[model samples]
Target: MRYHINFGQNSSSFKLAVIRALTGILLMTALASCASQGAQEAELAAQEAARVAIEQEAASLAQEQERLRAAEISRQQQEQAAEQARLQAQRDRQAAEIQARADAERRQQEELQRQVRAREAAIAAVEAERQQKLDRITALEQQITSISASVGDSENNTEFLQQAISVAEELLDVLASEQEKYEDTDSQGNTLRPLAKDLIAELEARKDELIRRAGTQ
Candidate 1:
C-alpha cells in the first residue's frame, strides 16, 4: 500500500518548500548576473553547496516520513502484540527525536545563511555608495559616510531581529499552552535559550553602540 502526505497546497510545508525554491533561485540568479567574475564564482560555489544540502535533506525527509507511516500502520495492526508494540514504540520515539533534531538544525542553518546573505548585501550597498562618492571625498570622509550608511542598514536589520524574537515568543507560548501538562527546560526550551540569549546580546551591543554614537553626535 502507498501512503500520501496530506499537507495541502495551503499548508506551511508547501509554503516553506516554495520559499526555499524561490530563495535558491533568486540567489543563483543574482550570482549568475553578478558583474564581478570573482564574486560570481565564489557565490556559485556556495549556491551549489546549498543546493546539494537542500536536496539531501529533502530526500532524507521523504524517507523518514515514509518510515514513520509504515511504523504507525504496523503499530496499529499489532496492538495485541504487547512485546512487539513495546519495541516499536521505543523505536518510534527515537525516530521522532532524531527527526526533530534534524529539523531544528536545518532551520538554524537556513536562518543563519539568510542573515549572512542579508549582511553581505547590505555591505555591498554601502561599498557601492562609498564608490560613488570616492572621487569627491577624502579617505576619512568616505569611511565616515560608509559607516553612516551601514548604520542605517543596521536599523532595518534590527527590525528583522525584533520580528524574529516576537515569533519565537509566540511559538514558546503555543508550546506551553498545555491544559494539564507542565513543561520546563525541555527540548523546546533548550532550543530557544541559546537563540534568545544571542538575540539579547546582539541587541544590547547594538544599543550601546547607538548610544555612544548619539553622544558623539
Candidate 2:
C-alpha cells in the first residue's frame, strides 16, 4: 500500500506539468499573430494618408490655373475699353473744328457790303440830269442873238416883214437842236438817252420861235 501511494502522487505531478506547458505555447502563438496584424494595419494607414495629400495638391494646382485665366480675361477687357474711349475723343474734336470753319467767311463779308450801296445810287441820278441840260443851253444863245439884230430895221410889215424872216429862221433852227443834244456820248458813260430827249425838244422849239417873232413886231 505505501508504494502504490507514492506512484500515484508522481503521476498527478506529471499531468499538471504537461497542462502548464501546453497553455504557455498557446499564449505565445496568439501574441505573435496579434503583433503581425498591428504592423500590417499601420502600413496601410500610411499609404492612405499619402494618397489624400496627393489629391489635395492636385486640386490646388487646378484652382491656381483657373484664377490666372480669369485675371487675363479681365485685363484684356480693360484694354479694349480704353481704346474705345480714345477713338471717341478724337471724333468729337474733329467735329468742333469743322463747325468753327463753317461760320467761315461770315457770309462772305455780308455779300461784299451789298454791292457797294448799289453803285452809289446810280451815280446820283446821272448828275441831276446833267445840270438841267446846262441851264437850257445858256438861255437859248441869248435869244438867237437878239432876234437877228432886230429883224434888219423895222419897216416890219413887208408881209409882216416876210413873216419876220421866217420867224427868225425858225429861231436859228431851234438853237441847233440843243447843240446836237449836249454832244451825245453813251455806253454807260452817261449822256445819251437820246441825249436827254434831244434836250427837251430844243427847249420847246425856242418857245415857238419867240411867239412867232413877236407876232411880226
Candidate 3:
C-alpha cells in the first residue's frame, strides 16, 4: 500500500504540467493574429491619403490654366479696340482735308466771276460815251450847213448879211472849242483837228465877204 500511494502522486503531477504547456501555446497564437490585422489596416489608410493629395494637386493645375486663358482674351480685345480708334481718326483727318480743298476752289470761282462782270460793265460804259460824242458832232455839222444856205439866198439884204456874219463868227468859235478836245486823233483814226481847222478858215472868209457886202448895201 505505501508503494502504490507514491505512484499515484507522481501521475497527478505529470498531468498538471501538460495542461500548463497547452495554455501558453494558445495565448501566443492569439497575440500574433491581432498584430497582423493591425498592420494591414495601417497600409490601407496610407493609400487613401495619397489618392486625395493627388486629386487636389490636379485641380489647382486646372485653375491656373483657366486664369491664363482669360487674361489672353482680355489682352486681344484691348488691342482690337485700339486699332479701330486709330483707323477712325485717320479717316476723319482725310475728310477734313478734302472739305478744305473744296471750299478753296469755290471761293476762287466766285472771285473770277465777279472780275468778269466788272470788266463787261466797264466796256459797255465806254461804248455809250463814244456814241454820245459822235451824235453831238453830227448835229453841229447840220446846223452850220443850214446857216450857209440861208446866207447865200439873201446876199443883197444888208440886215441879213450882218446877221449872217455874226452867226458865222459864233460857229467858228464853237468849232475851235470842239477841235481842242482831240489832241492826236479821233476814235475812228480820223484827223478831226485838221478838218475842224479847215472848216474855221472857210467860215472866216465867208464872214469877211458878208461884212463887205453889208457895207455896200
The most accurate candidate by lDDT is 3
- Per candidate, the number of residue pairs that clash is 0, 1, 0
* Candidate 3 Cα deviation (angstroms), residue 174: 14
Model 3: number of backbone collisions: 0
Give Cα distance to truth, residue 139, candidate 3, Å.
5.6
Q: Return the clash pairs for model 2, or none.
A: 158-161
lDDT by candidate, in order shown: 0.59, 0.61, 0.65
lDDT of 2 by residue, 1-217 (tens): 3544577888889888888888778888788788888888887888888888888888898898899888899888988898888888888888878877766665666655654554454445555555554554455456445545555655452344344445445544544554465456443334463543653565456555554656656
Please state the error at residue 17 of candidate 2 in Å.
8.2
Candidates ranked by TM-score: 3, 2, 1
lDDT of 3 by residue, 1-217 (tens): 3554676788788777777777777777777777777777777777778778888878887888888888889889988999888899889989989999999999989988876776666556544544554564465456456655655675576465656547665655656465455445444444444545466556657665665666566
Candidate 1, 1-217: lDDT as tens digits: 9988776755988789899999999999887777578787889999999999999999999999999999999997778588788898999999999999999999999999997787777656644543443432343244344444555556645443444444434433333332112222332222223223354345435544543454354
Error of 1 at 125 (Å): 1.0
Better of 1 and 2 by lDDT: 2
lDDT of 1 at 195: 28
